[model samples]
Target: MRLNHKYFSNLNNIANSSPQGIMKVSILESITNGFHLCCRSFEPVASAHILKELDELKTKTKKTIIEDVEKVKRLESEDRNALNRAVGIWKAGRDAPHKDAKFATDASI
Candidate 1:
């Protein structure tokens, strides 16, 4: 098989960048070595099993990413709502400067 040298070199750089990267790279190398050994030994079942695990890992990672995105969206919405409320309060205080000093103080606070 023709390998993508640039792609693999980039992956290697990423894998060597941090502690988590090191651990992930180590696991990946172990799995790759096992797959090669199984193939050489004519153990198709073992190779298939490794492929299945990799697929499951991909699925789990995707699920986690989706969940994280949802959480970020929710937090952003909450922050926008809060900012709108603050702006509304500030506007109200600015509109009625003499009627209520408390409103201006609360808004500033």
Candidate 2:
């Protein structure tokens, strides 16, 4: 697959000079390069799964951003109850840190 010179040139400009930084940047560039290759390579036999996943990601991202904006607006509009509920939920998650950790460890085991 051919790499895009323009993309690599942009990456090159932003990339740090350190070996690890360069390697990290090159890996990202390779993925960006690979995306074009994959589209071309898989065009003939592409499944609906890829489109479905992309759509799902788009939907979830939009929903998350919209909800965040709504939450901010609610807070700004002096909706103390809604703000308190949101804070309570956030704090509950933080208070249950060990629950998530144990669940992850249990799943791995």
Candidate 3:
């Protein structure tokens, strides 16, 4: 069965609503299409504009990540080093002192 324009348009709406959500959907679609082709011999073709939008979405996602990292770094430098250190230690398998500390800090500013 062919996916109609309405379906893709809905996907575009969803993609525009949230970048992370769009990335997840894109990854899932890619995997599903790959499996469909590999196991069922169904050839899936994406439209050029959809591919272009996906590319733009990826670029925007990377830019957002970079900006977030910069903000995190700024937080780390401005007397929030303790929170950063806590995050690092927690990431390395240690129990964090306060689980919501990072979120709290982020929300504060």
Candidate 4:
């Protein structure tokens, strides 16, 4: 929470660079630079392959979501109609020859 307060208080741009903040930033920068150095050789090829695959995956995911949404919408009215039919059937069951059996009066679809 302290991290959140510090971050959101200034929209992630710290107003004051205290000694602690400076040290933290320096450590982070050093780590980032080290990683960058390690990946420098493969950065170009790996980035191109990874980004293309990521874009393809994103497009497929979006298309699948759209299709699922349409399917659910089509089923929604059918589900409502089925529910109404079930309630009507249950109401009809009241006519059976069982004096002790009772269906709730407040059942509404």
Candidate 5:
């Protein structure tokens, strides 16, 4: 039982030390973390563009759910379905926005 206890202790230490293990598995959470990394890893203009896209994405998501409730409810079935499709498109565009973005080798320079 002593060996098993030591093994579990080592496993716990490894899990606690890693960000992946400590952080919740979530897209928004990951995106926020990515934003921080992007700021440090990219140049000013590149970072600004990437941050702008991410901020717009977050703002659009918030406004769509909170500010557009009435607008969504008033839509016809077909239109509502189209809106849902549009939301999916928006989600798909999230990665596309930064796919072509290049990171600076010496961002701090």
Candidate 6:
């Protein structure tokens, strides 16, 4: 457990050492208590050009999560058949915006 924390801290410090560094990394573990040992580790490394691909992936992931939550909300508030029809229409191109469509995005979503 001590070793895990040491490594995680080292990695985080190195990743954020640069004056203009923006990347973030984290590792969480609680096996010594009840969580888990280094169970969830998020380490992302990329070059200048690969950053664009990472951004695109992040956008897609956010969109998917948003749509999934919306679908759950709609299911809870509206009829299943109606939701299905709306999805079908959306899928069939009813001149609606794409689910993963990009819009002006800022930190304040």
Q: Pick the candidate with the highest lDDT.
A: 1
Off by over 4 Å in 2: 1-47, 79-109
Which numbered prediction scores highest in TM-score against the true structure?
Answer: 1
Candidate closer to the true structure by TM-score (higher is better), 1 or 2: 1
- Pairs clashing within candidate 3: none
- Distance from true location, Cα of 9 in model 3, Å: 31
TM-score of model 3 relative to the true fold?
A: 0.32
In terms of lDDT, model 5 sits at 0.63
Write one digit per residue (lDDT tens) for candidate 1, span 1-109.
3336686667678888867785556544645455442334445656788999999999999999999999999999999999999999999978875754466458565
What are the lDDT scores of the predictions, listed in order?
0.73, 0.70, 0.67, 0.66, 0.63, 0.63
Residues 1-109, model 3: lDDT tens digits? 4566777668767866785675546644655455443332222334565888999999999999999999988876875778787889779765546665565458566
TM-score-superior candidate, 1 or 4: 1
TM-scores, all candidates, are 0.51, 0.31, 0.32, 0.38, 0.24, 0.30
Give, for candidate 3, the lowest lDDT window spanning 10 residues: 37-46
Model 1, runs deviating above 4 Å: 1-42, 97-109
Put down candidate 6 lDDT per residue, 1-109, tens digits, no spaces. Answer: 3456777676667757865444333322343345443343322333554888889999999999999999998887778787888999888896776677666784545
Off by over 4 Å in 3: 1-46, 80-109
Model 4 error, position 26 (Å): 34
In model 3, the number of clashes is 0
Q: For residues 41-81, write the lDDT of model 2, one tens digit per residue.
A: 44533456688888999999999999999999877778777
TM-score ranking of the models = 1, 4, 3, 2, 6, 5
Q: Residue 9 deviation, candidate 2, in Å? A: 53
Score residue 107 of candidate 2 by CA lDDT.
58
Q: After aligning candidate 4 to the native by TM-score, how far in Å is the CA of 90 from where it should be?
A: 8.5
